[model samples]
Target chain A: MIVAEHKPLKELLALVEGFDRILMVGCKGCVSVCNAGGQKEVAILAAALRIARKRAGRPIAIEELTLDRQCEPEFIEWLEEPVKKGGCQAVVSLACSIGPQYIAEAYPTLPVLPGLNTTFMGGTVTHGVWAEYCSSCGNCGIANFGGLCPVTRCAKQLLNGPCGGSVDGFCEISPETPCVWELIYERLKNLGQLDRLEAILAPKDWSTSLSGGPRKIVREDLIL
Target chain B: MSMKTNLKGILEGSGFAVLAAAPAVCGTDLSAVSDFARLLKGKVTAVFAADNPGARVSASALAVSVKLLAEGVEPVLCMTTRDRNRLALESDLLGAGALGIANVQIVNGAHPSLGSHPSAHRVYDVDAVQWIAAATRIASEKTLISGEAVSGDPSFFIGAAANPFVKTPELHLPVLKKKVAAGARFLVTAPVFDAARLATWLDNLKKSGVTCPVIATVAVLPDAATARHLARAGRGMAIPDSVIARIEKAGDKSLDEAIAVAVENIQAVKALPGIRGVAIIAPGSETAIPRVMEAI
Candidate 1:
């Protein structure tokens, strides 16, 4: 999932300072699961903004709306009616970076502010811990390393690893972090696929990654 | 047609394999690098291609290596694990092999954030040791990590970097062991400013059972700023107070002082055991090479 964290209150307050009324948009997407920009989080932010404005003697009005997903225009179109009726001047998007960008493009006349800093594509590791596990390089080679993605797992992103910096199965960067290559080596050893370690991985074809440009996929059959 | 034939006299006569260290190839003027290679010609055994020296991304080291090879100089490509992923690194190795480049120095590259592209995403997919191991596999198996076969005799002399002035040289011994175990044939120390400390570190390395031929680095520090810059550049590399004082006292004659220091360092390193050669690293002061070589 795309992970993100809320921007500081000071910055958000500064963003909507001149606006008399504003819309706070949330997403039921990755931001919701990460507890960053979900419905609950949007409400909390709206309440905080109200209290902050009241203290500042401004007492601005706010209209909170949670969208299914802010990235798609179909969900974004839901805001047109509410924004027109509510007399809101600006919008605050609590979703990942895509949400605010989509809202900005959808309603170019109004100012759209981002409420969260879009972080890496990651998953919840434990209860509150989230670890990044993929680089989204477009080319996937997890099967070669016993399903451990070196592009995301190894600090150096080396196709071959262990770096001699691993001690007691922990990475050299931090003792708390387990060396991913060590894990892969152990897994390969257990699977009796250690010979797979002998092959050299080639340099990636970067045309598939951001090296080329913004990437897009189109299915000819699905298109009208 | 043979490149090594021209290098035989210099390699045999000096009793030391001198490697001319090129500056970082990022945004490099290749013609200048080629000219420098031509200038040194038969004076050096090989030219070492450096990665982003100031942490700025530029042309790939493999690119520079090929250019040097074209100039009729044997090239040792420097591979930094900080930017390119495993796939890119292996491709570069194959490319180097195809170009008849035979030497590679593997080092954990400077973090991308440290360079001009501070916001750039870094890919430290593998550290230097793993890179060495991977390159070794490519040289021997002639295949890639994805179990794909590549056509090339990617045979290479692997090299790794060492820091003599590290906080504790003893602590870095394990890293050296890992580097050698990962298939590094030789080691290059960070530029030596303090000969006694380097001698002590060499003794410790020997005691730790590391028998790889070490190439001592000697840098020409033309000024106090250059001294400080090198010290900061190497990350924990020490510049002795006495050496700094000498450069400071030399005032306008700092270049001469740097030359004297480099010459003195070469002499001291030559007296030490286990050192196969001395690599002279002078960025803007290539003229000092001749003086240092004359002393040799």
Candidate 2:
């Protein structure tokens, strides 16, 4: 899931300071699951902004709304009714970065602002903890390393094996981070696939990854 | 044809090879190179120039290698994978070859987070083994990793780093063997403080069929404080407590004691099987190198 965190209240407040009234939009997708940009968070942010504005002696208004998913064009249309009625001068998106981009495209006249910082594509490690699991490198070759992606896990993204800095199964970067190559070695050894590592894994084709440039995909089968 | 001077030729000869690591060449000063050459001209085989030791930014190893070459000393240019991608690495190698710098040491550089610029992004486009293989291709096959032909020969006497202290030889040995297979002519190791561990690693190397000559590194600690720091820092390079205690007990003679310890390590490592030479690393100074070599 796409993980994100709320922007500092001060920064968000400054971003919307020019506008007396704004529409704060939230998402019910990954942002909601991560407890970052959801319906409850939207209400809290709206109330906080109201309080902050009222304290400044310039009481502003905010129309709060949460979409099923801001990334889909169909769900983005749901904002039309509230935005039309609220007379909101700007839109604030509390979803992952995708929400604001979609909202900006949908409502070109109003200024779109981001209320949260999109961090990484990751999954929840615990109830309140999240860890990055993939880098979306386009090419998936985890099967070669017992289902572990060194491209995302290893600090250096070493293809062949661990570097000399691996100490006691932990990376030299921090004791908290387990050296992923060591983990791969252990996993492969347990599976009796140690011989698989005998062959040197070649340098990755990074052009398939982010190194190539901004990426895009079009499915001919699904095209109109 | 190979370059006029190369580490492989020196190591392949009958005598025990001695590599003196020059102090970090952080600027345009070639006086250190001349001084180092004058001090160890007849005594050493090659001068090693490290790339960003401690991950702190320093002068290019190729630039230092050029200085060593000018002083009539063979230079081993240490190249790290952390700083540049395959294109830049290949370009540097080609440039080094043109400058008559033949010996190249490939290492997975220390993480940038551990360096002076902790927030700097690292480009490990190719790991050490992959780069070693790519370098070998650029040298021997006259082709790039992309299979592009070079206009001229860019030969190199390739070397790779080894860590004898890794707890998991199950994984380390295969990579070492692969490095040799990928055309690393020699293997230089991290500083060896534990002879037993080194011997075990050597035995494993032999059993794994990696017959490349191993050059053990022996670092000269200037004081007990540095020893304590290294031991506490936990950078994965081991410095035994006994050795640290010995240095600490020396009081004002800690520098001498450190040199003596390095001498002892050199002698001990030279006696072991598969050991071909020792690279003396005297941090912040090359004065200890001559003393360590003379004592050994």
Model 1: residue B230 alpha-carbon error in angstroms: 3.9
By summed lDDT, the worst window of 10 consecutive residues in model 2 chain B runs over B3-12
Worst 10 residues of 2 chain A by lDDT: A158-167
lDDT of candidate 2 over B1-296, digit per residue (tens):
77646467777775578898887866777687678877887788898988988788877788778877777888899999999999899999999988878889999988999878999889999999999999998878899999999877677888999999988888888889889999898999989998778999999999888998999999998688888877666477899889999999999988889989998888889899988989999887577788899756
Assess the local accuracy of residue B277 in candidate 2 as a C-alpha lDDT between 0 and 100: 89
Candidate 2 is scored at a TM of 0.94
lDDT of 2 by residue, A1-224 (tens): 99999999899889989799999999999999999999999999989998998999878799899999999999999999998999899999999999999999988888999999999999999999998889999999999998898998999888888888888889888888999989899899889898878889899898978899989999999998
TM-score of each: 0.68, 0.94
Compared with the real two-chain complex, what DockQ does model 2 have? 0.72
Full-model lDDT for every candidate? 0.78, 0.88
